[model samples]
Target: MNGILFEKMRFTCQQSGHCCCDPNIIVTLTYRDLLRLFTTLYCDFRLLLQKISFYTLDSTTSPILEKQMVLETILTSDGKVIPGLKKHSKKICVFYSRPSCSIYSSRPLACRNYPLAFVKEKELIMSTWVKNSPKTCPGIGKGSPLSQKNIEQRGKRFFKEIEKHNQVVRELNVEASNNRPLTAREALWTLIIYGESEYQQRQK
Candidate 1:
């Protein structure tokens, strides 16, 4: 019975609208993400290079500042904290139109491996990302089929990559504290230049 049930559990993405509408969708980008974004937007990387802002977790009601942080953390009077980051709307992802992901080539890894989550313990861990109300993604139960084995394998790889990405952030924090302010780009560089397992593996 277990074997029969396992065999029945396979997924093939139909590119329904559900992925875009997922409320839990979080968009965290690294340096590579920015480069891809620039390329996708048809803008020169140098154009964005000159203007980079450091995001600090603070309140600034000041109207005088020309530049405002897109991402911020807010603390309520009750001491509850919230990230001021804006979630990517299903209507907004360049690839999210009617049928499928438009920018599949440049889409972030997080998007590529949806419905799967990774947790960092002593090592990378994989788990299911089930949604109670998958409003937009109608393809969940109807689409092409993917095997459980493939999903598990991909999840493991994804988490390892993410862990490396996190390490870069940790290293950047220390470096920024010792030196000057780091921009979004520089922070991204920390991830790619340092976190690439290929490079790290070569060193050992």
Candidate 2:
């Protein structure tokens, strides 16, 4: 119930674009994600910045509010918070284009592993998905079983990149806790441009 539960699973995209336009799913961005997007779009960081917006957790209701990472949170004058991607005014993905994803080639790991989430526990990776997601995803149970080897490879790469990205996020979180919260501009610089050099320096 908490996370996914599967050593291996079956899934295939129906190309319905339901996942891309899912009203409930908010695609969170990572350091690698931003870098890839900037590269793929041949755009500058400032332009990409306009696409991201913050999604804060409700401290009042969230029991583990303090447990949230800095990258997830916005250090507003009010409180710390978790940030996420901004959506179109119609509550759809910014890159969603009616029948397909605008940037499907370089989609984020989260998008890549849709309907097949990996939950790494200690030395294992457990995969899982919504029980009845086929209501919208016609490809579910319609194709041959998904290849475990390939899925593992993708999951491994995703977690590896995630660890590296979270390293920077944790550093920013520390600054927030120490009363040195990064300003909006500084946060954007660190999120979009700087990777781990600043955090690495703090260690030395």
Candidate 3:
């Protein structure tokens, strides 16, 4: 936990089911997150969760959509879109149980860092609890101050993993554009099964 910040933030989860029950809260899954789920669920992302696609016009892609994120997309009036997750009928997360998260241990990064966000600038990753965390969450400012070092480490690892993930996705996106465009499921399978020599060889 080598960092410049010395102050700690108090937060202890009460498990009141606020975050999990909220319909508006979208849990964005990363490549690693999906891999963890695949391993946990016996390689069944198709059955347990839905594959949401997000499209964006980027320079690296040719007359096509390319983005690392694959949550439900929010299309703007002007045709702009931002991807996010799809909630259940009540806006509850897909994995939310009655009083707790079904996959609490393997929850996505967004769930793990709920009410708090981290941003990376150069080599420094900074964290800040959301202003509304205390309003809706009972855990904030209630327990021992959270170690800033721990938060920094989590943030660092998140960014590091995502960067590696995006690199692989970008390659796939380019390949899809030049050849035949792959379905969302295909793209997701590529991400979930990335790094294997089989996928690489097939791509080549």
Query: Can you list the residue pairs that collide in candidate 2?
Result: 6-127, 55-84, 72-82, 72-83, 73-81, 73-82
Q: Which ranges of candidate 1 are over 4 A from the true structure?
A: 1-9, 21-24, 35-43, 46-91, 119-124, 130-136, 143-145, 185-204
| Predicted candidate 3 versus true structure: per-residue lDDT over 1-204, tens digit per residue | 323342566778899989877654556666666666666667776653463434344445543333324332222222323333456778776677788887778777677777776666788787776545667888877777778778878888777766766666667656765777565555556667764443468689
Which candidate comes out best when scored by TM-score?
A: 2
TM-score of 1: 0.58
* Model 2 CA lDDT for position 193: 66
Question: lDDT values of the candidates?
Answer: 0.48, 0.66, 0.62
TM-score of each: 0.58, 0.79, 0.73
In lDDT terms, how accurate is model 1? 0.48
* lDDT tens digits, residue span 12-42, model 2: 6778888777777777777767766766767
Q: Report backbone clashes per prediction.
A: 9, 6, 3
> Could you arrange the candidates by TM-score from highest to lowest?
2, 3, 1
Off by over 4 Å in 2: 1-8, 64-83, 130-135, 196-204
Clashing residue pairs in candidate 3 are 9-146, 23-91, 72-84
Ranking by lDDT: 2, 3, 1
For model 3, the stretches where C-alpha displacement exceeds 4 angstroms are 1-8, 49-85, 195-204
